[model samples]
Target: MPSTPAIVVTDLVVDRGKKPVLRSVSTEISAGTVTGLLGPSGSGKTTFIRSIVGTQKVKSGTVQVLGHPAGTKPLRRRVAYVTQDASIYRDLSVKANVAYFAALYGRSRHEAMQAIEGVGMGDHADKLAGNLSGGQKTRTSLACALVIEPEVLVLDEPTVGLDPVIREELWDRFRALAAGGATLLVSSHVMDEADRCDRLLLLRDGVFIADDTPADLRAATGTANLEAAFLHLIRALEGVN
Candidate 1:
């Protein structure tokens, strides 16, 4: 028998006020691999992640984390979410911010320092979070999330506003995390980052139109790159009218 997925959804549907944001959507993410949620802006990537993280309640269907129903406090404690906006305390120093998050997760200051060093932010530990550049802030947020040693990590537009070098470094860390047996679900508009994932879920108009590896997607659409493949997929989906 096949193993249960680390993350699963069954006919999940979410409505925001008058309009529906997700329509009977279902997908699964397994452990030890990275799943990229690829979509254009306003395509419900954030909303979908939010739903799984318990920040948004669905109107219908069910979501399960590690085989349990969503929103259970125990399940939530094992999941970490990093939003597009920096969720750190801007007024605090990098070390202080990480220490505070660690405390929330029941870790000590020494454990927080270990996490900061592990993410390569030890040198800037004393710098104020708000004083750091965009990439630095991103790294700091990631460090805080890592301090909890979560089983599942959900990131939305993690590399936004980062330079190419820093983006590549971050991608390397993501690959390392997946290699070490963590389940990762990341949303990004950047094709380069999407290509690094083991699999991709293409989202358009608040629905998943394609779910496959980056190479498979490119081959299916006869496109040279992920961006072109996305364009082809969108055009084909629209042409179905």
Candidate 2:
């Protein structure tokens, strides 16, 4: 039998001020796989992530995580979400912030320390989060999420302000997490980053225009890269009869 999906959304819809931000969006994210959500600005990528995180209410349809309905606090506990804003305590030291988050997730100090070290932030543990550079802050946020050891990891524009080197490093860590059996749902405007995912879910005007592996998407669109394929798919969808 095929493995059960870690996440399932059936005919999901979300509206924002009379405008439908998501229209009947449906997709499944499998265990131990990295699924990238790709779209342009205003395409509702963040909104979609918010819906999955249960921070945004939908108008219709169903969402399930680990077979439990969305918005269940217990179910959410097993899913970690890292927003693009890096919502860490700016005044707190890196270690303290991570420890606090871990505690919220029921982790002890020792476990939090291990998680921080795992993200290569051990040396800067004492530095204030606000004093760190953009990349360091992003890494710290990711460390906090990892401290929970969640079964599902969701990230929105995870490497937004990071330099190329740090972005590559973060991608390596993400791949490692997936390899270790964690399910990942990542949203990115960067086509290069999206290409690294096990599968891609392309959004256009709040709808899923294409869902396929990078290789398959490229093949289907006869394009050389994800960006080109994305454009092609959007054009095709727009021209649908």
Candidate 3:
């Protein structure tokens, strides 16, 4: 993997109505790798993602994507954000939704079809997005992001409600994207997904508690699994060790 950093954040501080969501958070995400942002449901994962994507306002900090400031016009085409909710037009066909985004990036219908198939949505390309299942909708949303071929892709709990089979399929696609040199930062509250990442950024209540690989986390905590390792960290942080 390349050693260059795709994203860099320093002292990022965000607040939601006087309550701090992320406090003095700073980290570097390596290029061409899958990095997992793991924490509990309210551990500021979404807030951090919004900061990187330039959607959420921060109280203090600097966020740079591919060397440019986050949310700048130049970075718009190079960075793609797939939200937790499906961002497709409910009334449009799956192919049409993907094609629409493709057109925005000056892509062709052929490329759009390729992106649709890349997410394993080829069979449902003609189906209305509103009529599809939850997993199918998520796939369509992913296809929309893939059509642009972004250099840095940020996903927020993409597999939240997916079954085992579909979740595995989506993760395989993520690995393929990373192998193709796209940097990915995926957020999840599920500790089991930690091993799927090349690196891990563990957060708890707006503070970073751990940043290491799955193996390193296990080794440091002397735990058999990531879930147990996470619990160990939490307990240590709370002075219960």
lDDT for residue 44 in candidate 1, whole number 0-100: 86
All candidates' lDDT scores? Answer: 0.87, 0.89, 0.96
- What global local distance difference test value does model 3 have? 0.96
**How accurate locally is residue 8 in candidate 2, as Cα lDDT from 0 to 100?**
93
TM-score of each: 0.94, 0.95, 0.99
> Which lDDT tens digits does candidate 3 get at residues 35-85?
999998899999999999999999999999999999999998999999999
* Ranked candidates (TM-score, high to low): 3, 2, 1
User: TM-score of predicted model 2?
Assistant: 0.95
lDDT of 2 by residue, 1-241 (tens): 1266999999999999899999999999899999999899999999899888788989998889888887687775788999888889999999999999988878899998988888778999999999998889989999999998989999999988788988888889999999999999999998988778999999889999898999999999999998888888877777952
Which residue segments of model 2 deviate by more than 4 Å? none
Q: Report the number of the highest-lDDT candidate.
A: 3
Report the lDDT tens digits of candidate 1 across residue range 1-241: 1234888988888888989888888898888789999888988899899888878988888888876776688875688988888789999999999999999989899999988887778999999999998889999999999899888899999999999888888888888888878889999988878789988999887789888888899999898999988888888877952
Error of 3 at 108 (Å): 0.7
lDDT score at residue 201, model 3, on the 0-100 scale:
97
lDDT for residue 99 in candidate 1, whole number 0-100: 96
The window of 10 residues in a row where model 2 has the poorest summed lDDT is: 1-10
What does candidate 3 score in Cα RMSD to the true structure?
Answer: 0.7
TM-score of 1: 0.94
